[model samples]
Target chain A: MSVLEVNHVSKSFGSNTILQDINLAFEENKIYGLLGRNGAGKSTLLNIMTNRIFPDAGDVKLDSENINDNDTKLGLMYLMSEVNLYSNGTTLKQIISDTELMYGDFDHSFAARLIDEFGIDINQKFGKLSTGYNSIFKLILALCVPVKFVLLDEPVLGLDANHRELFYSELIQSYSDNPRTFIISTHLIEEVANIISDVIVLDQGRIMLDQPVEDVLAKTHSVVGPAKDVERYTKGLNVIGHDTMGTIKANYVYGDLDDRPLPDTVQLSNFDLQKLFIFLTNKYEGSMHSEN
Target chain B: MKTNQVTKYLFKKQIVLLGELYLFAFAIIFLLPLLLSVISGTLSDYSFVGLLKGAHIAALFGIFMIAISTLSYENFKFLIQNGISRKTFFEAQLTVYGILILIGNTINLFYDYLIVVPLTHASTFNTFMSLYADFFDNPFVSVTFNFIFSALLLVFGALAGMTVGSFMTLFSKLTQRIILIATPVVGVVTMAYVANATNNAHYQMSWVVNFAKFIIGENGNDVLNPFPMMGFLLVLSAIMIVIIRYLFAKKQLKKA
Candidate 1:
């Protein structure tokens, strides 16, 4: 299996750092959810990996070969950035045709189907497309390009509820049909929770958590009930965060549970991916503030 | 990635643009004379081919090149999004311009002979052949001289256009604004000073005339050899190409 590796990558704009010694490895045939807060270096990391921007320190390698300025290796991956790089006057059909030419291979039939389903006029200029259609067209490109790895940054930026759901379904179908690696960085966590096999979380220029979605969800629990009982039951565990309402409280813990008997009016249950992500990122960010 | 393929694509686009320009120029070049003849009933008096000469072609080609340079930013964004590296992008852009400089000069030469020469019975219509053709006994040698002279001018003009284009695209907005503001201010000040009848201004104007004489190899009665002008163009173009390449390599792309 082919793998993409980022070795000790660090990036900054001026004196303000964006990514700090970030190290990551993504293998083939896996869907990864890259979660990060606003300005958490998610876009910068994706851009650096694709060589859209350079990293100040370290390099990106694919299959142990340096991909920097290497056309053969760079051709095997694609990054659908948030900004549209195609000319404004170019029609969608022309853009698709040019993209196919550049990549040397494209799923024309699949692209046609997506274009039709999305009700996009192929003859209309890219500049004329609304924000939703722009994102739709970009995502279609991300899914259709015949590459080993597809990195999507804000894939559903302007997508509506219906379109987002359609996109997720199509994404799963495409993965099942093609079996390529996908690294999707987005703020919509609950939606991609069940879709991505692995989750990598970033907070304040650091990798806060990287684990399989199932493992992350399994280790995470919400101790809900009376405030005192919940606190007692969750004491000494990795209590990342909590929500309290008067006498009642729910503690979000992320670790192995103790074998102690449950006290009266205290209950324990599993938490979703979004809650765990929130807890992890908020804890690290809060810690940074406290340290400062 | 696939730098050759990308270069070929860019070259084709430039050719298409050039072809459109040729079509427009040809229409105006050929049709305007006929229109004037119909309206005023006199065609022999009007200078048709002389209106467009080698220097004029150089200026037109320079403008075409400047336009191409302005598009470099948009092209860079598109190509980078398609996974083309900066090195490949620079190589492809230079290659396209290098090829265009040759091809464009040849096409201009072809048009001058095929269209302009037949229209006017004049022996020499281009800047080089107008003054320097007497040195060459044969018409073929004179035409070749015209081609070389025009090509050298085209290259120098292209370098100038690329400089302007690179400046506009590669630099920060503030830097561009400062340069834009300063160039005209400096130009107007120098023009005002040089326009004066002072002895210093006359000395400066005489120096310019002497430089022109040296370029033309003119001692009032000698053959105007173009070797000096060719050498000057080649050296200046080499230096400007280096500066342009440095700017290309060092440029950090913006999000816009």
Candidate 2:
């Protein structure tokens, strides 16, 4: 029954506004994908939510209480980001112990299993961990801690294909067992496309899209046909972006499609999340120029 | 529950980890006399017990410096990330440092006074046991004053450590460098001022000595009352704890 709410939150670094009046609520027992390009303020927003950094204005609350300095509420949430906040000399085992001591409960057996599966040495010093293993180590903590909300910022930063695959499967299994909320912020959209239930797209310090995956995909589609026929068929539709290949063209359009008869050469396909995200982010500032 | 966990966390980090290094240093310092004796084929009359006592006192300052230098904002960030509030962090520090002071004083008393002084039969070492014997004729009062003085030294070292830690956490690298360069100059100037003030009869009272005497329950009139000194230390410690909390709470994660 817990709900994490960010109300009227805004932050600015000198003249550059990072987050502008961001107001969002996360319900319980759901997976939310936080999608944003570089410098889109994804990490900043996550940092603020976890109390790693204070926002310039407004507050983040858990249920009805302010989360800042509230141990009871903060204990219910965790954030795994790129920052190496762990001390230099601490070992992975010590890290787990410290985390368990702080959060009051941790899945030791599960963490051990994941450590073995990933071939991560629990005795190794945290500072000596490689980039990929560091991510894996943090990912393990994110999964094992018995918290209500886990915000993962770039969870698979240096993970390879095999590790990423293993992580996703383990994540799904963990989610199935615990059914807590997870907000994964990553650039690898295609990999997490099917796993995430909700998609929150941020662009230029603003939330461009916040909807269910199905709803977002339903409203966006690609029309593929000869250049002349494709342009003629979708002239009045909302064309966010498009791709061109000599005579053939596919216009990535958003919004409802008209119930008109289609040409034989025309092909209609559902929009992929990555493509939709690209178009949505690029639609503004006239940067969605068709690739020749 | 949260406070206990944080206390345990800090104890493991600060005491257990750093205690090993400190004990190693103490062992080396304590064994210096034996090593010197072995090299010379005969021990000199210089009191080994006195040397050990001196080393223990130096260890107190070392403890404060090491603790403060090692206590960085990284730990603060780590604790907060794990849901430890600033208040809890402050409480944990005070409890840990206070316990450290008590434990340190007990060990000093046990080995330096009980074992070393008796074994060495060093009469000079007995003087510390009756440090203010000339000023206060009562043996009990003198010993109590010595114990309180030792405790105060430990507490003052801890306060300095906290101040240094807060300075390191609050300022940028450039500002820290500037402060580092200026600290010695400031200390020298203050010491010179105190030395110069000692020449004047009207300013004959050394504030440091007076403060120590006041803490040992002896005022200018040689009055014995420990309550005021004890209360002053408690208040001072409380104020330092508040300062530590405020500095940590206002610590910025990243400099812009």
TM-score of chain A of each: 0.94, 0.93
| Candidate 2 TM-score, C-alpha based | 0.85
lDDT of predicted model 2 = 0.81
lDDT at B253 for candidate 1?
62
Task: Flag regions of model 2 displaced more than 4 Å.
Answer: A225-237, A246-249, A258-267, A285-292, B36-50, B58-62, B111-138, B141-149, B185-232
lDDT of 2 by residue, A1-292 (tens): 9999998899998899999999889889889999999889999999888877789999999998998877888898899988888876889988998899999999998898999999999998999999999999999999999899999999999999999999999999999988999999988899999999999998878898888888998988799999999998898999999999999999988889888778889999888899998888877535535532
| A241 Cα displacement, candidate 1 (Å) | 0.2
Q: For candidate 1, lDDT tens digit of each residue in B1-256?
A: 5878678867877888888986777667767776888789887766654555422554566678767765677777777677776678777887888799788888767767876667665666667877787877888887887888887777777777766766676676788888889999999998877677545567657878898888776767778777877888888889988887766655556644
Chain A of model 2 scored by TM-score: 0.93
